[model samples]
Target chain A: MMAAEKDEQILAMIKSGGNPERGYRMLMDAYQLPLYRHIRRMVQSHEDADDVLQNTFLKVFRNIANFEERSSLYTWIFKIASNEAFTFIKKNNRHAAFFDKGENADELESRSVSTSQLNGEQIREMLHVAMEYLPVRQKQVFSLRYFEEMDYRQMSAVLETSEGALKASFHHAVKKIEDFIKSKNLY
Target chain B: MEDLRDELKNIGSRLDPAGKNESWDIPEGYFGEMQNMVLVQLHESKSNRPNVNLRNLRSGLYAVSGIAAMLILAFGIWFFAERSHSIDPAGIQELDQDQVYAYLEENIDEISLDMLMTDKQMESEILFDQPQSEEDWDVLLEDVDLHDLNNIF
Candidate 1:
């Protein structure tokens, strides 16, 4: 079934006066993976992503009554998830204090990467480090475009930006990431 | 996805799949457990919430009573303000000379000679304000001696 049709059924079930829990579970089952992956990419930590995703779900549950479904249900959920991820990043203060010293990158690697392949781990670390240098909005644009594979129209809905501005931001973010990789001699 | 990759290709960039070779690991059955975790958290939060109708009724009562109290306070202030203005100063300002005399006669027992002396100035005029007009002065000076005027000066 199409996601839109599924979403309509789920909305009906939840808005029905009986057995809203079933609807909520269905909603989570449909969205949890994509939402988790998006949040994980933005926050770069499993624990933080977990918190953000759970918080996102909690907000969705609380505010579903207010969700007018003006945008697609998926877009609405993504918007909440994006906002929660940004809130986590802003509250942590670690994302801002990352300098050329690579202290936070090393720390993030130790906490997040527990792999045997050191080369892939280093490349992932380099990517995260480069992403860290991006401004918050630009990084969000890049993550939504690149990692989440969100088109500009859907992204425009979730980010509340014009398609032109989002396209420009994504382009700048990619260029910046490419430059960072080149400067680090990791390209 | 094709369009995005194509656009990037036009930009001469190789951001293929955004590090597809480097994948993040998740706990086993994470998505499976996610629904249960979220449901548990939701139920716990809902249980912890105050009763919605009761909370709304309480806030409504508070808001209505607050508005009533503000109105009563405002009315009380306006009533007292109006009464104070109309009772004392307006009553006196509207009174005539005869009414003033009548009031003084009625309240004379409440007043003392010292209090009366404190108001040395005559009513409707100051006693020493060149007490007479120029006509009176001219008439008095017409009957006065030059030496008397010099002595007064």
Candidate 2:
């Protein structure tokens, strides 16, 4: 089926208070991996990312009744996932060491770490380390824009901020990451 | 440079696929475990609802118990009062009068016996000044004489 038709059918089922499992499963099947990757980048740990992903889906399930259809279902789910990620970070801000060490160790130990892969991991590590220097909202905007390739309007819906402000945040974040990468001699 | 940007964007796109078809291996019966967890939470919520209802019922029972106790107390008081009244009717009447007089004496701050005596004396003087006619005397004698006939009983 086409995207529009599928969305309409999902909306109709939701409106009729039908089994939420079907709709939720559909949503999970469609957006789980992208959201998982997005959360993984933000949180930088596989375990934490998994937890946040589950929580995001649970939140989406619980709050699907209030979805106003103002944005695409994709955007709505991303918004929920983003909020859950921020909340997780805020609650576990004291555990910053956990994020850094785990990502580094996991990247180094993985069997995929060839010389080329090492270069990619190095760049990823530099970006991840520089991400710590940026403000939380800026990091989120930067990741979504540059890494996730989300447009400004979609990000505005997710972050509940103006597009202009998102643009500025992305600009600042990119500059900070670039400076950090240059200073560290990371390509 | 534009080509590099496009290439970078393409690489970024590949970084996170919309549908990766990647599946993680879980322990056996992971879905069952998850389903069990959900069921446990559902049961908790369901059970908690009844507990709240029971709490409300307990409160209602307490209210009913209070009303019943009050009714029993009222009935006991009424029963005791009636028993006392039946035991000594004349004594109770006298006790009621004494209670009334004691209540008035305790509550009334500025009572004057002098005014009460003066009112009684004035009424007596009026009675003494009234003429005693023969017809009035005859009626009085008749009232007293008729009671003498009751001495036979």
Candidate 3:
């Protein structure tokens, strides 16, 4: 039931390469929700998140043999999910489309948060739109830290970034998000 | 790290932080559906792998076909050229002038009357067109080098 125990069991099953169907099912059961949430936050659309999540698991299954156990399985899984999210975005040029509306960042922020709902739901949607404006690494660091509550050390392992750099990136992201919130008067 | 967290806490205090429990929605039973879909995809991938030996066999067959086609084309060209330049040894045997004369005499009856008339006209022309005089003969002889006769032969 504990994450560590489950990770070890899944690792053993996958490493054995026997009863791979059971192993794969267990792997999916263990990681599916968490990985989906992570991917969903990054991609910001249910359909795209679904696709990225599936691809992340598919890549995991395909490349499970090459997993060297150098890092925790959690970190490794997040790393793969992150890479898949980034690749999907880049390949589809979603970043360009998100930014190429001929609207300034201030106007875009105002438009995104201009929903009928005036509660926390509106704020959350506004936050999501604001996230789209961050540079790639800053967004990633901020998301992992704020949403997932990941520590700098774990983030470093997953992102392969230095902890100090991740710390800097997170602060920068926070400042940007705060400035956007103030400018949009979404409060 | 604590400073970063503190700063984030301050920034998101007025706004709910982006969290997993945000109001995103998915179709009902999506994960259950995805499991089956992913398994099917994996199985299809496994099934779709090209057989190594089969691929190699196909390649070999293609290579053999290409070589055979080239050989057939080359042979056809050679056959065409050989046929165009073909000579019959029996038909090309050397003949003496007497033999030619005898053969012509044998075939004289086969010649048409018109052909005989044409031949007579040619002979008359030649006879009438003889050298006019010794001077003319000398001029013609001067134009002809007997040594060059060997070159013609």
Candidate 4:
């Protein structure tokens, strides 16, 4: 179905008195993975991602009654997901941890979570670890552009950043990840 | 995952964009379970809204304030106890000192052991329980105006 038709159906089911829970379930089904991936990348913990995603949906459900049609449903939902991740990261002190690390451990060892380590791991795993070194905003820009393949316009709507700034952040994120991986000898 | 070697080499050159890999750690079926957990949480918060909302807070405040106000008023009355308007000063002046001495000597043993009562207790007893009423002596002492001290007779 087209985006507008799907949104219409979802909204109708949710607004109907018959079974609104079913509509909520459908909404979850459609947006859960996209939101989860974004959250997991930002938090670097499966448990934290689960928390953030649940909060995102809870916020969505609580605010759905006031959803205006100014933005597409997809954009609105993504915006919520993005905001939740940022808030979760800040609340959990993930940003503080990254800043305190001073960015200098070539053989970073994290037994619980290989957040920025590349000790004999594959290039893919190293790539995952390297992305962890980015600032929260840059990491998000990179995740959306590289993995989610969101265009500049979609990213701008969700991140509420200008297209030029987002492109610059993404560029800086790519360079940082590449440098981190190579300098750590994770070739 | 696309190789970043090309991108690394091109960082100083053409600056080709790098690749992405999504092998993050997660529990099995986390997304499915997360949805159910969220729904359960929503249902729980909704059902508990009665106890969590502002209406309950307002009601609880009123009940607490009522009890506190009653206690403060009762304490204030007790703390500021004054001579009653009904006390007959002339009646007390009419008793002879010899008659009072004789009465005290005869009833000293049953006079509430006033020696053992604290000064405050003795004062309170003398202030409130000195009068005779139209009932059994003990009944008048224990009951009468004290029945629902809440009415503050």
Query: What are the Cα lDDT values of the candidates?
Result: 0.79, 0.65, 0.76, 0.72
Candidate 3: misplaced stretches above 4 Å? A96-117, B1-20, B50-153
Model 2: what is its DockQ? 0.06
Report the interface RMSD that candidate 3 achieves against the true structure, in angstroms: 3.1
Worst 10 residues of 2 chain A by lDDT: A94-103
Model 1 CA deviation exceeding 4 Å by range:
A96-104, A107-125, B18-22, B52-153
Going through the candidates in order, state the TM-score of chain A alone for each one.
0.84, 0.80, 0.87, 0.84
lDDT by residue for model 1 (A61-142), tens: 9999888989999999999999998888778854533243222555654543444444755666666767767777787888
Off by over 4 Å in 4: A96-121, A185-187, B1-19, B50-153
Candidate 1 vs candidate 3, lDDT winner: 1
As for candidate 1, its clashing pairs are none
Q: What lDDT would candidate 1 get against the real structure?
A: 0.79
- Please give, for residues A1-187, the per-residue lDDT of candidate 3 as tens digits: 8988898899889889778888888989888887887777666768888898888888888888899989888889999998898898778766523233212335545656666455666566677667777766677787788777888899999899998898788877777777777776655
State which candidate, 1 or 4, has the greater TM-score: 1
TM-score of each: 0.69, 0.54, 0.63, 0.59
Interface RMSD of each: 2.6, 7.6, 3.1, 4.6
lDDT string for model 4 (B34-55, tens) is 8898889988988987656788
For model 2, the superposed segments whose C-alpha errors exceed 4 Å read A1-4, A94-118, B1-153
Candidate 2: fraction of native contacts reproduced: 0.00
TM-score (chain B) of candidate 3: 0.34
Candidate DockQ scores, in order: 0.25, 0.06, 0.20, 0.18
How are the candidates ranked when ordered by TM-score, highest leading?
1, 3, 4, 2
